[model samples]
Target: MNPILEIQQLTHTYSAGTPFQRTAVEGVDLSVMPGECVGIIGHTGSGKSTLIQHFNGLLKPTSGHVLVDGRDIWAKGSDIRAVRFRVGLVFQYPEYQLFEETVAQDIAFGPKNMGLAADEVARRVRDASAVVGLDESLLSQSPFALSGGQKRRAAIAGVMAMEPDVLVLDEPSAGLDPRGRQEMMAMLGRYRQQRGATVILVSHSMEEIAANVDRVIVMNQSKVFMDGAPREVFSHVAELEAVGLDVPQSARIAALLRDRGLAVGEDVYTVAALARRLLALKGGGGVC
Candidate 1:
């Protein structure tokens, strides 16, 4: 099967050709398969944000191409708006974007814009609401009146209502408490599984990426630093630290334990995984 999203030699320069010009992303190449959950992690100014904007035509490449289903999004006559619908992006703090009078209206915004039938739009609103775990009773209430977590989910429901083939979230869990963050991540998992959507998650949290994504892409200094399964990428702890990115706490501890000749696995990245490995060692009398 063809990749649902592909980027080739992509570059984006801000304030181009001026004294204050800066290249945010440079010569990056990557492809995301349909139905895949991919995580992108990097330090601030590392270009991960710039790279994701190109996924849905929000930011056109300064050079090279972003292809959705084998077609360049920037090609002449390409329907950029349609591309946006196909690749739904939820910006950081999406709750701040909510503005409709009611939660239902807010959730229905995208489908309505897509010119879907009113009945279809309503159905989508309901479905998206359920996916995000918003109560039906909340539909008639003002979006502004909802709790912080509810507002965030409602805003996400707005994007999901579009039924995008690819869901790209930039810091979707930012600013939430740990429980709220876990709930948001679980909601994302439900949407991806239910819709079979390709997901691109951009986050600064190694724990979130390690626990949630099937594949990890590391960005550093406007370049693709490492791309592999979570275990493979997080395995290079020193390299990640050198570029000013943190490895998950579990991964760091596991690495230290391994250095001391413990039997914890090489691929431990999550707290649960590390706990299991250590427990197994203890059960076997390998740890006193």
Candidate 2:
């Protein structure tokens, strides 16, 4: 299958040719397949945010190209706005962007802008609200009146209302409580399942990536550092650490056990997998 999104030798330089100029991303090549959940992980200033902005033409590349379904998004006469509609981006702390008088109105903004009929927009609003677990009764309430978590959901529903083919969320669970974070991730999972959309999650948490993504892309010093499945990426714990990124706790524990002579696989990054391995060892009288 063709990739839903592709980046080729992409580079973005801020304030080009000026003393304040800096390259946020350089020579980055990546691709996202249809219906795949990919995670982008890196420390602050590692260019994760800059990289994702180029996905939907939110930022024009200083060089190279971004392609959506094999067509260069920046090609002459190409409609970048159309690309944006196909690749919905939910920014970090998205709740802060909510401004409509009512929750439903906020969620309807995207669809309405698409020239959709009012009824269709309303239907999308309802569907998106349900997908994000927003209460019907709250649709009429002011967005500011909702609690933090509800506001976040409403904001996300706004993007989901567009029903993009690819959803790009930057720190979707950032600043939420543990339960809130879990629910947010679960909601995203359900959205992907229901829509069969490609998901690109940008986050700082290895645990989040380990638990949610099908593949991982690690960025360091404004370039692609590693790209692989979770097990493959997290197995190189030392290399990840050297780039100021942490592996999941379970993977770290597995590494510690291996150092102490326990026969555990280095790729065990999830809690469930780690627990199963320990139980198997205990059953074999290797360790309890």
* Tens-digit lDDT string for candidate 2 (67-174): 999999989999988898999999999999999999999999999888899999999999999999999999999999999999999999999999999999999999
* TM-scores of the candidates in the order shown: 0.98, 0.98
Clashes of each: 0, 0
Tens-digit per-residue lDDT, 1-288, candidate 1: 999999999989999989999999999999999999999998899998889989999897899999999999999999999999999999989999999999999999999999999999999999999999999999999999999999999999999999999999999999999999999999999999999999999998999999999999999999999999999988888999998889999999999998898877768999999989888888898954
Instruction: Give residue 222's error in model 2 in angstroms.
Output: 0.3
Off by over 4 Å in 1: none
Instruction: Quantify all predictions' global Cα lDDT against the true fold.
Output: 0.94, 0.94
